[model samples]
Target: MSRIGKKPVSLPSGVTASVDGQTVRAKGPKGELTYVVNDEVLVQLGDDGIKVDPRDTSKDARAKWGMSRTMISNILTGVKDGFEKRLEITGVGYRASMQGSKLQLALGFSHDVLYDVPEGIQISVPKPTEIVIVGIDKQRVGQVAAEIREYRGPEPYKGKGVRYAGEKIVRKEGKKK
Candidate 1:
């Protein structure tokens, strides 16, 4: 049995959730989100909260049960409080800035790279070396951060590049003369 699936997703204050067939919808002050559960999993809203269970004892059903539960939980949290991701740029001449709806990046490249911010997501630069992304959908916030990081990922040798905030890079030894 999946421990995560066994626990019901408690609704945060100011949040409401409803189940329609295999689709679950959550609405809150932040925003609204919907998730379609797999057929192998069963979802129901009860007094305590939303409950998830495997439709059968098959491997696929068990695997999807936990994932479906987590997805429901994420939507609830997203609609209530939202999600955020932060990135830090470390290197000489490496920085980030906002140009209207685009994110301007100077990651040692010859020309500055411009990333068009997607809808439903907000990007802010508190400092030249810091970038903050906010969105109601947790997956979209993480995906935007990952795409930005991929532009100038940290190198093992000097660990100079863009990385997630609080991320640790395993530094490699410099060349021995």
Candidate 2:
């Protein structure tokens, strides 16, 4: 049995969840989100909370049981409080700013990198070196942060680039004299 799947996901205050066939939709103060459960799992909304059970006692069904439960929980929490990711730029002349609805990044390139902001996601640059990505969907927030970090990953030698706020870079030894 899946430990996580055994536990139902409870709806917090002001958050509502509905079940429609294999899809589960959640709405809260922040926003609304939906999740389509896998066929190997059974999803239902009960008095306690949202429950996910395996359709059969098979390896694939068990695997999807926990995953489906977690996905439903993520959508519930996401709609309730939202999600955010922070990135820090570490390099000379490397900075970020907001241009209209786009993100302007200057990472020692010949020209500034302009990233068009997508719908339902907000990118904020409080400081030139700090970038905050926020959205109602947890997956989208993380994906956007990863894409931004991909632009200039931190180097091992100088560790100069964009990285997660608390990420640690493994340094490499310099050239021998």
Candidate 3:
């Protein structure tokens, strides 16, 4: 038996979960998310909580059984509480601003980089150097933040670029005299 698969998934007050064929759908205050379960895995809604079971006792079946359950649980939590990612600009003149539906980033480049905000995700600029990305889908929020950070990755020497908040950049020693 899988430890994580054996655990019950508690449903929140405003959240609803339903299993349709091989797919599990969760609806909450923020939004709804759907996950497809593997053929070897099965999910059933119980009176107290959700139960996950594997059709076969093979290694792959056991792994999928546990992973599917965890994914469903995360979807429930995400729809209820949402997700957020924060990024910071480190360069002297590098900054970010929200213009209409686009994000304008000045990263010491010849021209400012403009990024269009996708639907369902909200981008905010609390400070010119700080960016906050909010969304119910964890994957989408993370992807957007990563793309922005890739535009100007932190330099090893000066660490002057965009990076995740609270992230540490190791500085390398300069040339020896």
Best by lDDT: 1
In angstroms, give how far residue 168 of model 2 lies from its true place.
0.8
RMSD of 1: 0.6
**Per-residue lDDT over 36-114 for candidate 3, one digit per residue giving the tens place of the 0 to 100 score:** 8899988888887778899989999998987888888888888999999999999889999999999999999999999
RMSD of each: 0.6, 0.7, 1.4
Tens-digit per-residue lDDT, 1-177, candidate 2: 889999999999999999999999999999899999999899989999998999999999998999899989999999989999999999999999999999999999999999998899999999999999999888899999999999999999999999999999999999998
Clash tally for model 3: 0
Residue pairs clashing in model 1 are none
Candidate 3 Cα misplacement greater than 4 A, ranges: none
lDDT (Cα) of model 3 = 0.92
User: CA lDDT of each candidate?
Assistant: 0.95, 0.94, 0.92
Residue 56 CA error for candidate 1 (Å)? 0.4
RMSD of 2: 0.7
Q: Rank the candidates by TM-score, best first.
A: 1, 2, 3
Model 1 worst lDDT run, 10 consecutive residues? 73-82
Ranking by lDDT: 1, 2, 3
Which digits, one per residue and each the tens of the lDDT, describe model 1 over residues 68-125?
Answer: 9999999999998899999999999999999999999999999999999999999999
What is residue 173's positional error in candidate 1, in angstroms? 0.8
Q: Model 2: what TM-score?
A: 0.98
